[model samples]
Target chain A: SQTIHQWPATLVQPVGSPLSLECTVEGTSNPNLYWYRQAAGRGLQLLFYSVGIGQISSEVPQNLSASRPQDRQFILSSKKLLLSDSGFYLCAWTRQGGDGYTFGSGTRLTVV
Target chain B: QQQVKQSPQSLIVQKGGISIINCAYENTAFDYFPWYQQFPGKGPALLIAIRPDVSEKKEGRFTISFNKSAKQFSLHIMDSQPGDSATYFCAASPPNNNDMRFGAGTRLTVKP
Candidate 1:
């Protein structure tokens, strides 16, 4: 079975602080990874996606970036956090040519 | 612009009733439509999916109705239960497209 892990479950950080959220998948290799952000009571916004190691595609221009350091390890980072950057961050993966994605538990980030 | 649009941002349903959520897309190239369910503080999970080739697909209590000519699809939950209360999202994607476009979510509350 394939599973995704994301941490920390919740985060509270001050404005302008650096941020790092990590996600990893087990039981699969060369799967496509994606990052999505959902504001409270709002729609999900695509952040980034990677097809392979060292390859990332950003969907929107924002104060964040994503990296695929290893085949199953993805990281979301920001040099400086803003109040608007707080949201629920999710990591998902899909097999090549698969029908749907499997998502992680998600991280609730609060930029205070 | 959002590629997929979903309606009824919030819904209240009585247990044993039916819950319906609709979604529309403008992209004619989209070949896949999927619905996701998310509990509070958790990431979304793939609940059901339908391909453009099918008009309706049912899995247990869940059903997806796709109207290819109308460019719309809907999810129906029969005998809605309290455990089914959660947020639902609709998404669409074209063939070979690595990115999936999600609609604004609908929050469903089934009162027992």
Candidate 2:
């Protein structure tokens, strides 16, 4: 079975600090990866998605960026975080032409 | 343009009742419809999905009803329980699309 891992499970960052969240999927190759953020009591907002290594599409332009370093490794980063950046970030993967997606545990970011 | 539109931003139901969430899509090319469930501080998980070829699909207490001609779909949760209190999202995607568009989401609270 495939498993997705994301870390750190929870994060507290100061305003203007750098941010890095990593996601890795085991037992799958060349999977579509996505980054999403959910505000408190709100639905998910798609940030970015990648089809292959070094290929990323931004759904919404913001301070955050995503990268696919390897076939199974994806990273979300920001040079300087903003208060608005605080939310629950999720990383998900799906096989090409697959029915549904598998999501990681998620990273709760609190920017103070 | 936002391809998917969901209704009833929030809903409250009594235990053992039924919970229904509706969604409509503008894109006729969308051939896949999926419903995702998310708990507080957690990532969304795939609950159920349906292809345009099917009118309805059921899994345990969850069901997905798709209307291909109307470009609409809905999720029905039977015998609602407090454990089912969470946010539910509706999503649509074409067969060849790499990205899936998600609905605004509906927060469902089943009170015991």
Candidate 3:
């Protein structure tokens, strides 16, 4: 069974602080990883996706960046957070020919 | 061309009734359509999915109806329960495309 792990279930940080959210998958290799942000009462916005290590594609221009250093390890980071950067961050993974994605528990980030 | 639009930002239904959510996309390249369910503090989970080749697919109490000509798809939950109250998102995956487009989402509340 494949499982995804995301850390810091809830986070509260002051504005301008650095941010780091990590996600990793077990029981799968070379899986495509994705990062998405969802505001309260809104749909999800794709932020970044990676097909392989050191290969990340950003969907929107924003204050966030994603990295895939290891095969199953993905990280979302920001040099400085803004009040608008607060939302629910989710990590998902799918194989090349997979039909759907498996998502992590998610990180609720509050930029205070 | 990559956006998936959903309808009825929020909905309220009685238990044992039916819950339906619709989604539309303009991209014909999208071959996979999936619906995800998310609770208050949890990440979205894949509820059901249907490919363009199939007009409809059902699993348990969840069913996906895909209309290829209309480029629209819908999810139907029968005998809805209070525990089924959650936010639902529709997403599309284009063939050979690394990213998936997600709809705005619909919040469904089933009152017992």
The digit string of per-residue lDDT tens for model 1 on A1-112 reads: 9999999999999999999999999999999999999999998899999999999999999999999999999999999999999999999999888879888999999999
- C-alpha RMSD of each candidate structure in angstroms: 0.8, 1.1, 1.2
Model 3, B17-83: lDDT tens digits are 9999999998888998999999899999999888888899999999999999998999999999999
How far residue B28's Cα lies from its native spot in candidate 3, in Å, is 0.5
lDDT at residue B47 of model 3 (Cα atoms): 90
Q: Which predicted model would earn the best TM-score?
A: 1
Which model, 1 or 3, shows the larger lDDT? 1
DockQ for model 1 equals 0.82
Residue pairs with colliding backbones in model 2 are: none
RMSD of 3: 1.2
lDDT of 2 by residue, B8-87 (tens): 89999999999999999998888888999988878899999999999999999999999888888999999999999999
Judged by whole-model lDDT over C-alpha atoms, candidate 3 comes out at: 0.92
- The lDDT for every candidate, in the order shown, is 0.95, 0.92, 0.92
lDDT of 3 by residue, A9-106 (tens): 99999999999999999999999999999888888888999999999998899898899999999999999999999999999999967778888999
State the lDDT of candidate 1 residue by residue for B12-103, as single tens digits.
99999999999999999889899999999999999999999889999999999999999999999999999999999999988865868999
Which residue runs of candidate 1 sit more than 4 Å off their true CA positions? none
- Chain A of candidate 3 compared with the true chain A, TM-score: 0.98
